[model samples]
Target chain A: MISFQHNRREFLKSSIGLAGLTLPTFLKARAESVGSRIPHKAKSCIIVYTWGGMSHYESFDPKPEAPADIRGPFGNIPTKTPGIRFCEYLPKLAHHSEQLAIVRSVHHKHGGHQQGMYINLTGKDPVGGIKAKSRKNWPSITSMISRFHNPTVGTPAAIRMPYSMYDNGTMMAGEGAGWLGSKYDPILLRTPAGKPYAGVNRYNDRELKLERNIEKRRVTDRLGLLDQLDNSLSHTINGSTPYERLDHYGQMAADMLLGSPVRRAYELEQEDPRIREMYGDHIGGQTLLLSRRLVEAGVPVVQALCSASDLAGGSGDNWDTHRDHFPKMKNRLLPVFDKSVSALLTDLEMRGMLEETLVVFLTDFGRTPKVNNNGGRDHHPGVYSLAFAGGGIQGGLTYGSSDRKGVEPGSEACSPADIHATVYNAMGIDHHTELYDQQGRPFQICDGEPLPII
Target chain B: MVGTFNVMEKLYYIFAIVLINSVHPLQAEPEALRDIERLNGIALKLPEGGWEVGFQLRGQKLNDEDMEAVVRLGSIVSLNLRDTQITSAGLAHLKKLSMLRRLHLERTKVDDAGIGHLTNLQKLEYLNLYGTKVSDEALEHLGQLHRLRKLYLWQTLVTQKGVNKLKNINPKLDISLGIDLTTIVVTNQKSEAKKKTEDLPQLEWLPEEGAKRPPDRSYTGSFIMVYFENNRSKPVKLYWINYNGEQTYYANIDAGQRREQTSYSRAVWLVTDLQEKRLGYFVTDQNTSRAKIPLE
Candidate 1:
């Protein structure tokens, strides 16, 4: 495990005196209240989902000895770990490798975009053939966790910020509560599409609040009347199945507008300007900042989708490098990922919250080991890399390995289920723990065995 | 008989004059002059037989194609292509302009590769590569420009080591490195200014006993930029934070000069005077990337 004491010592010895260091109010609050709740081993979980496939060859699993076309353009840089290295573009992250556990041999069978997303998000296969999002799909890991935890009043049990994932035009499956029902779904935290590099806006500004002149009592009376209407409609419609989502929405709206810690927690402007600057003003950076804020406010889980700055405006390429892959990855993708992700890790550690915050990085799948005719790697489900840190993780270690060419798992092969199981383990959930679905059918939360990460 | 003899003599003289005119060569202007003129560039014919080639003032239209014309000016003393589209490939044309004393490539695509083409400019006294892609590697090619007096590398990829190496070779060369930030305003003075907005009371305002509290801290993120503005009328040494969060010798901002650095976020800027005496340390806030520290 990486020791904070050693890091602190290194920091002081190598840096300036911490004179007049008035602690931030938010940090102080997070430190005191994050530990108040007692059920889970970790207080919060922040899963950085690289929605599209980030190339293994260009990132974690580099094959320097492979042919030029296979190896691609970038070279590898040494990390804090003695034997491991990351892509040259990730120099900042390389310094924090000692605090990370990279699993390079994780592989799954699905290669289609939505198929991979479904598998990774839910840690389970789709019930029927792969298709668009449906209520029949399993609840995502976040939604599953939300099912068990009672979130602090005014805050959500789990949250997915900025946006939900979509493939082409269809909303992908496995992002919500699924069969577990909409009540357990991870609520979407909305951020206005600002300039690509303006960082995040004040969190309170983004909160869903009551309209001007809307009295609290009047709102409550309206809710009562709506409930009465909904009751009659349920009878006429034969069940609440059709309006189950509406019921959840009403509850969420009431929770947000009535009184909640969410508005205060979203007040990012209260944060030190230097802190906002540090996280950067770009979409990826700001979203990560929002995630930190959400977790600090007692939200149990936050899934942040990492997209390119150009695409953060809601349209453009992701890590899905189909053409001009080298330039896109080097210029547009990796630089922002390196800065923001590394910033998140360092920020978490510095705040003394790393121990209680499980930081996980995963993607849909890995890219093909060989370069394509377009000088890009196509999708490959044979092998990929995933990483986890904090939440009692044993850092500075590789859990598995890819083959010499990074084409397949070579040893200690772990799948997405295993990775999710590891997260469940960190959150103090048993992988074998079974819960019933909406139809009263029993289902295990995860099937794969959790790796001995701690 | 005398009249006939005079007519034959006149005919012979006319024939001889025609032959002489045909034998003489065409005194055409140099090809370089024509090329420079095509781009509406101004070329002054120097008294020493050298040419001063430049675009009209505020006429930044000359590009790489016009640079090829420079190769014909064997005695070209100066060339200005500021804010032009000339790239590294265009630098090759300057290889034959060996007598060039001044070259301006400001805001161009001149990278490390292009710096090599100017190695033969031995008499080069002034070189401006501000806002280019020139890196530390290009410093090797510049070492031979011993007569270089002024070098502008603002917003470049050149590092301190490269700057030091070039300084060692050409001690007299004055280099203006780092971003030019005269426009950034210094508005916040925490000591004098009252809080504009009162912060809400937080649950975790104070730390409990013996819990290993992180040293009282402020700020967040990965990095921030600090600007040092010399408000004084004389050059003075200033100390600033580095990437590793260390306090070290930053730079000497000449009178009315400004320099900036991108350091790790939350670093304490320990500004020092010319004698290495401590100046007040200012915490880097987030509202602005340019932390203007006006040196009094």
Candidate 2:
């Protein structure tokens, strides 16, 4: 009689299981159903966003065959891969070609920085007037990937370092969690070491300034205050209310500040000075270093803006090279970027973390093929280049190509959505899966197929 | 007819139960998995088969006993015991994980004895034994791991002879024998000395009274360093003309003192008195340069 009763219960449980599928359970079911359809190679992801549009002609897709006006002054050099070539300025990165998979035909329609950045980061087209904190916007790639990750206690699911993206004082949209809500927003952390980028870095109360040197006792005191507030408000709040979420953040902040491995990771002085020099003594380099550390501390996703926080009309150490582009790329930008990124790749490889940690490169758009009278390239949305390394990505391969004149995609054209899908595929996420917004409206996460590069 | 319907329902329920159990395959020992996780070990189920367990993050408290619990779950494809308290004895449990492809035992107390157990892990592709006390004997055991592609012997007791011997066995293996620590210090010192002795290009200073007033505002350019020397008798205040043409105060350099300032090329720096009175200005270039405040 008891066995009969248990069988009836099991029948009921199986019927209801499909409807009550949590993320982890759903993923497990999906994994089992697919049975090796997707390879889950990436344990963590690091998105390196070059805020301003990096030039394809100068970085990955050098058109030595193009006319002088289109090719600019820099010559091309052979990479480790015999057929592949990079700009003369990026010699260090050229040597690391074996680990890089450069896609040269990524095209998008949005030419403006805001829309271009929005499309690149969110993998979604921008509607009218998208605000940074609006919940209606699609979650950033970092936030969306983080939603699938279940980090250990007190560890953030996602983190973005240095500072937020801004253009001419206005903060860019699509950096936050968006419709996924604040719970999934990547925590913003300030890099505590190295030379500062020559531009404005605005900070609000929400950013975790680890450089403040806050003592453990002060964190305890703050937690005590929060405890008092919780005691007073616990009765008023019923379930997971906004106040409760804020309380949760407070506790997490305390945990990170008091004794979390993340706090120890922030102590850059503890790192070997040799490794620090390898990454270069720049804010951009240190941020990448911090991203590696956070991944070591179990943060699932980290987005590093590898440029100045604000692109004040092409005035600082940013990729928006409106004037003097050749000299800037030669002297200031390329050296640091080339050295730091190569160092990161070497470090991760030596530590044996590269196999499981995915490093991706994203940008606003590509620079124009023709050098303007001011010796700079304007925003060219026709086509661009991006790259992926590690995390099971097959290296020393170029997936697509731009036209000989460097005007637009010539072959194997792809979109930013395809890039996002590739990332999802590497991270073992079903890109076709659906997520619900706060209003319980279901939306498909990605609308593109994963590229075969992975 | 009623007795027949009851039997049919019972059989249908039994079929559903079997299907559900097969699909879910309840974890063999949930409590044991939880126990290992409680010690800050992460056990992730891979999409293919087996698990990738890592205890590198906050797993300092984890000891040899935890390995026993880890092996109980079985089919661990990748295991990271970096910076754990596990000794040689703990590795005995790892023999059950024949499917293991990657193992990180760096910065642990594991010696040659621990590595001996890894010989049977024929499928292992990566082994990180950096910062261990493992000697040539460990290498002899690892030579049997023909499938091993990467081996990190940095800071280990293994000699070049052992590495060469292993290389002879598997020529395709990528071994990393990291550089000595002492060389890094020497290189850093050499670089610092070189930087100090390097000459900086001089910037042409425009007196406040003479020459066309510097452009109303600064234009953005590449990053460069400027060494500003206040040679004037009185202390001078330095301000950078921002992109918007506003004077943003940067530093207050005392007489005869030099300040190393980071700025972008084509940026304008204005020198002033303590009372906010403007004196002269200098414009930065692409290279690291010296901006000397005139004595006159």
Candidate 3:
């Protein structure tokens, strides 16, 4: 178990003064409050969900030993780590490999989009069949963080970026606060570019749309306003009412939109010309810069979505690339992503947030071992790759290995639950602790080992 | 050469309209068909009870399926859909406006469908389709609006299109689009940052122990934008207490939406002259994402 004193020392050093006076005071006040464990090392955890299946071939798990058909057509590049290799396009991230570990073998039983996505995201089978969605209402990794670690600091405990959209109006389910209850729900903030015209709008003024595109949220006043509304509108503060939850969420949203000093970080225009240039002129680099800013602001969690621009395409830039996969990965996707992620690792280590800030890159699932008729690999949940760096995770180590054809986990087939369990364990949560389900039934947070990552 | 021919044809029509004392003798003027001097494009709305007044699909969701865009006749009025997902490419065919007034393409994605054809709006007034992609070049064609009074130029590149001199000629015209960045997000006092360090006190607004606080604090602020890093960046949630030690802030909620409905709420905060301190900001998974001011 992690010690409180050592945790506090590391927290002060890693967080770069995030909690300011708040955390130190709370750590001291713990003597009188709950006799609870002071989550010391990094008081937060950030799980990056690279939504659509990201391709390991062009990213982390490049198989240089394989033929052009299997390895696709990208050059293997060296990293700061002695022998670890990345796609040539990922030269930016190559320099920071020392801070990361590429988990080469994570397999699962689900392969369909809905099922694979469900299992990897919720850490369990959908409960119902493919026809029926995951109605089990399992808590997302972020939801658990919000519930178990409501640190007395930061503006939001959990965050998703850009925004998740679905076909028609159906939003991507399983990314929200499932059985964890409403109070622990994450404040879902969508970024919409505004159009200014009229002098009037319920949103305030028309001219004010100038400030419509920044990322910061005003947090303090929002809370105070909610408190005022709560008192004037209701009798007693119910611990678990939709009213309180909505008010709480609304206040969090309003605060983020209005208060947090995060807007500058989100705007790529604010970064130094040289620094921005290093990351390349793209969305991924801008996101990396913003992520760094958030960790600095004392936010406990930050989830940056890593997308393949388009998920369809060669050697497998997006894992599901069916046709025209080769050129797309060779030209557009891999090179851009590589530079940005590389720049991120270097920036984090330079800033020192790498110690407390755990950066994880996880795709929906891996690719098929057998190439399809269209020259693309379909979904292969049997074996995939994930990467974790910083936040106490050991580096330059391959935790598991896949079979020769990359057909399955040859050495150790780690399930999604095991990965989630390892994440919670790294952050000091007892991996086997049973969290309550919606019905008050206890369910283990993760049913796997920590992969001996340390 | 065709444009030249059209210009010559328009001059001939002008001569005939001026020389002949005919009521509806000439269906339309050539210059009205094109050119900035005789144009009035802003109020592209139609007159009531004049023509068939064909249907318009405003505020409806659009898609990639081929759209049948047509307007036979009728004075279209009040396209006051300030915020819709319509694009300039979609609104390309609405150029034949014989009787349109109060065009409110304020938030539609209208572009230079016809920077030259815009001069066709003879009776145009009160034009706002401000947030469209119509650039300052569109302004050159807009010079024909002698009767145009209110022009919505927010979020557009009109100023660069030589509207500075145009505004001088039409001083009565109200031209604006967004926050006019000259006002906010800028520091007049080049020394403002320094001033805050020296003048702005450390507002210990955190209430004293057991001290009774005021009814509450009423605050107003603006959220310029929100960026979700999808995965790595943290969410925004804050908690606070008053001077009397009363909990004043709430905890986490995603996008901070209302539980039952879709909310489009923006917030503003209040700050006194006292030295106020901010605890850490609640971030989600990523390292950091910044929040900006001046609302772009």
lDDT of 1 at A348: 69
- Candidate that would win on DockQ: 2
lDDT of candidate 1 over A14-52, digit per residue (tens): 111111011111112222233222233365899998867
In model 1, state the lDDT of residue B90.
86
Q: Write down the DockQ of candidate 1.
A: 0.01
lDDT of 2 by residue, A74-161 (tens): 8999999989999998998998899999999999999999999999999999998898888988999999998776565457788998
The TM-score of candidate 3 is 0.50
Q: What's the lDDT for residue A199 in model 3? A: 12
Candidate 1 vs candidate 3, TM-score winner: 1
- In terms of lDDT, model 2 sits at 0.80
- Winning candidate number (lDDT): 2
What are the C-alpha RMSDs, in order, of all predicted structures? 36.8, 8.9, 33.3
The residue ranges of model 2 lying beyond 4 angstroms of the native Cα positions read A1-37, A211-254, B1-28, B38-40, B159-161, B178-198, B201-293
lDDT of 3 at A345: 68
User: If both were scored by DockQ, which would come out higher, candidate 1 or candidate 2?
Assistant: 2
Model 1 lDDT at residue B174: 74
In model 1, the Cα lDDT at residue A424 comes to 83
Q: How displaced is residue B77 in candidate 3, in Å?
A: 71
User: Considering lDDT, which of the candidate structures 1 and 3 is the better prediction for this target?
Assistant: 1
Model 2 Cα lDDT, one tens digit per residue, B28-137: 53444455545756665666666677788756777888788888767678888998998999999889888999999988999998888887799999999888899988
